[model samples]
Target: MPSSTSTSVSSFSHHFYTLLLLSVLLVAFFPGAFHYLSSLPFAYLSAASSPSSTHQPSSDQGPTTTATNTMSWFQKQFSLPPRSRGSYLVTDHVASAVPEIAQYKVGLLNLFVQHTSCALSLNENWDDDVRADMSDALDRIAPEAGPKGQELYRHSAEGADDMPAHIKSALIGASITIPIKDGKLATGTWQGIWYLEFRQVKHTRKVVATIQGEKA
Candidate 1:
């Protein structure tokens, strides 16, 4: 029979080997466990690592952390239905096509008109006369060629009104930016978007709508 001292020594050695094997297995299977546990919230690993720690936050003062998504970016392209050679109020129309913009709590919504003969702008929303006035003003600035016997432009490959259309597009601009808030456009009470159609004939237009911001 083994002596008491020898038996106790053997038992101690077996326990030590068992513990060492367990530790090795843990490290082998979970190489990053230490880092992951360390990075966890204090309360997560504190109970086992620090039983007497008084730095624990109370129930009421529990982690005030909130889950938030990382800064995001999204873009989409949509077509603007064909319209005649006149400035038209299309604020709601564009927004309707891009429901994703309404999902954003705050961000900048951008509209880029791809056609050179058509452009985008911001102007009065109410009163139809504002659109008429803008159309008349642009006409005066870059009137369609003909009738008056004025062939002032050289690029007539498209048509008599084509060159003036390009000029008008340049004047109005090809894109516009609007602030989005509360899942809707933050346009002024009287502000609206305008798609300036410089071409005499109607043609389908494509508008690239890009929105970036936090979701509500």
Candidate 2:
């Protein structure tokens, strides 16, 4: 009986030492792999519990976010009466033309001029001298005639001021973007939209306005 017990104890000790050595080798050579294997059970538990434990809907309000917050767009085209070559304030004209703008709460207004010889800009609205001064400055930059009263450009198919008008139109932009809030333009107190006409003769211009925002 004593000899049988001693043999069984020796076999068990040999198996225990083999398993311990294998575990130590794995820990020393593949630490990351061991860690990932150890975390698999926890990850499985989390995934299994998430569906029932985390995403419980409330009794009152369901998913109402996308339905309530929707966006809309509006567009309009209007014409400006023929006027002499100069800078003219046209804020009120735009507002009157696009009455649909009042239906928006927060949005953007983009005013684009269809003609190439004319431009749109924002500048001082309260003073008339500013307009005259701006026109004078632009004229000096791109004059129609030289000092000897001679034409300076080659493209004069329209008139003496045709090339100069094109230059001015390129310098100043043909489009202006303004913020719309509470159904009105959010320009500063002294700021207004300017339609710069560079032609020598009075010409009618077309403007297209677009609005994008949420309704009030």
* lDDT, each prediction: 0.85, 0.92
Clashing pairs in 2: none
Winner by TM-score: 2
lDDT tens digits, residue span 1-216, model 1: 889999999999999999999878887999898667667877676667865634656799868444657655778888887888888898879888999987888999989988898899999889999889888998888876556777879888998888888898888899999999989999999999988888878899998888888888
Worst 10 residues of 2 by lDDT: 61-70
Model 2 C-alpha lDDT per residue in residues 130-200, reported as the tens digit of each score: 99999999999999899999879999998889999999999999999999999889999999999999998
Best of the candidates, lDDT: 2
Backbone-clash count (model 1): 0
TM match of model 1 to true structure: 0.68
Q: What lDDT, from 0 to 1, does candidate 2 have?
A: 0.92
Candidate 2 C-alpha error for residue 182, in Å: 0.9
Candidate 1 runs further than 4 Å off: 1-69, 146-148
Instruction: Report the Cα lDDT for candidate 1.
Output: 0.85
